[model samples]
Target: MVERGEPVRLCLHIGMPKTGTSLIQSVLQGLRPQLAHEGVWLPPNNLAAHRIAVEAFAADSRLSTRADVEAIREAITFEEAVAHSRPTSEEFTKVILSSEYFQQCSVPLLLPLLEKMGFSSEATSVVAALRRQDRILVSGFNQDVKAMHRSTPLIWDPDDAHQLDWYALLTPWAETFGKDAIKVQVFDREVAKKESLTCLFLEACDVSYDEASVTSLEVSRRDQENASLPADLLAFKFVANGVTRPGEVDWLIDEAQARGVGGGVYGLAEETVQAILEHYRMSNRQVALEYLGEDGDLFDDVVTAPTHTDLTVDPVILSSLLAICVAAQPRAEGARNHHLR
Candidate 1:
């Protein structure tokens, strides 16, 4: 399938999260100048492509009968804004959307949309990175607690046990599109680090790797403070619409240091992480064997995650987060007009 504005070449970079997706995206952003020099347009629309893909997947009854299209549509609205802001230029001809969450959608749903949009399997390249299950969950939970979100209940199991079944999310890509077209890399947070991963990913996206180093600038606006909820709070939030005052939640979250609660409190048990990993690994192992055989070991290898001390938060992340929050909230027409003035 082909898209009107999309160049003949398209790359869909899906992911196994915490695999330096943010860092990769930032680096990709820097390459926009160089990419434009090469006639490539990394449309801002893909900034939230995963959310759109997921929403689309859920909304299509053929893919997910219980799916909520409105939720997904709302998520894609941010990407739409980015698309709207793009300037018409001859330098950009191709477009790419990068996100890990896109992995959540079912292939059946994605294929039809792409076909309908004129993007065929032949014209698309899929990219994703994998990390050790053990460490991925640890960092993911830490992110959740920092944002005052809910953590998983399973926290004491083995490493590689507490995650969404990886195979369930990834295997389909290899199945739908030949494994050769699906670029899967095991992310070793230590060896390549963030910048290195960006370099590797850019190479996959058909972009230049020599242009610049990864920026500390955070561009995504998604909130990460999801820790697991206490039963009552969960019930209230999910059931009662959990109406939270804007900015109030952030202030309450800032008090974490005084409370002496470290972010680890939100992590799932080690066993749970391991279980989740093994559950998916079981299915993924089959795909690996089918695709790689003896060479499958290369794909199954683990990438060591970096230590907390090494990960730094860029202040820019705050601005981007605020932008997303404001976008999600309802604004009065007069207020929007006043701001514009």
Candidate 2:
């Protein structure tokens, strides 16, 4: 809370990605006026806080790992835009910096930085909304593929499942922010289905939910042409560094969709979803109970949709054919650049 004469204390909302951050941020960004009226100023153009945070973390000398720097840079680039466009006001207004990548933040890198930024353990509220670990991982994999326009289905090895642990995501933030300062919530897909979850989240932020209908809850992912891979997915796995253009990736996604080469890359099987939940339950029961509360049953039900199969172009649409023809031709970059390494 800002006193009449005191500078407003910043409240950072570090996200764990894929947990509805895009929808919430989009809604808040759209309702800037409404938010300001309630003492919550959502900056319309200051959207780079994520990038700033990442760059800040990457530049920190305390952490020696290159992976940490790379991750920090990505998060900082995405978040910095949100932090720089704060609303002007005499009253204390909450300035939020949100991104989903912070789930992997290291405490040593996060703690001292928060202190340096005037966010004390008491002033900082490290917020994270967790889904069941298994589901989060699968969704993350799909999201990764979507961003790169890869058509192959992401296969999981049970041995590598530790990468998706919810506890691992939370423990660092909790340790750095202090357990009491962290407000961790478990996501209920059913509540999202009922359209009540957004309101609940806004309410937690002390913002009104009257404009929920006008606010879009659309999930952000890569364009439709980038979500799945074909049977020949390995060729695109390691594109040559400078030659692989993003447009070529979209073209590949379109071609794979046209040929119907993969199943449910965007959507996972029901059993597979359930198995993930079970795996999380077996692996991270303590973490779930600690973060989600003992009574929370949101993880019991697995959420899924049927495999998408609409890969064909409309037969009678001339414009669609023309668009495809234009897309099919190489756009300065092609197969020569396709390599992950």
lDDT of 1 at 274: 47
TM-score for candidate 1: 0.60
What TM-score, computed on C-alpha atoms, does each candidate reach? 0.60, 0.65
Give the per-residue lDDT digits (tens) of candidate 1, residues 235-338: 22222222453334543234333343233122344445545555556555654565435333323433333222212233443344355446545654668888
Error of 2 at 37 (Å): 2.8
Q: Which stretches of candidate 2 lie over 4 Å from their true place?
A: 1-10, 43-46, 56-89, 149-153, 190-193, 212-244, 249-275, 282-284, 295-298, 301-323, 326-341
* Model 2 agreement with the true structure over 192-254: per-residue lDDT tens digits: 566544565665555555654533433322121123343133223223112565454555555
Please give the lDDT score for candidate 1: 0.52
- The number of the candidate with the highest TM-score is 2
For candidate 1, the clash count comes to: 34
Q: Give the Cα lDDT of each candidate.
A: 0.52, 0.53
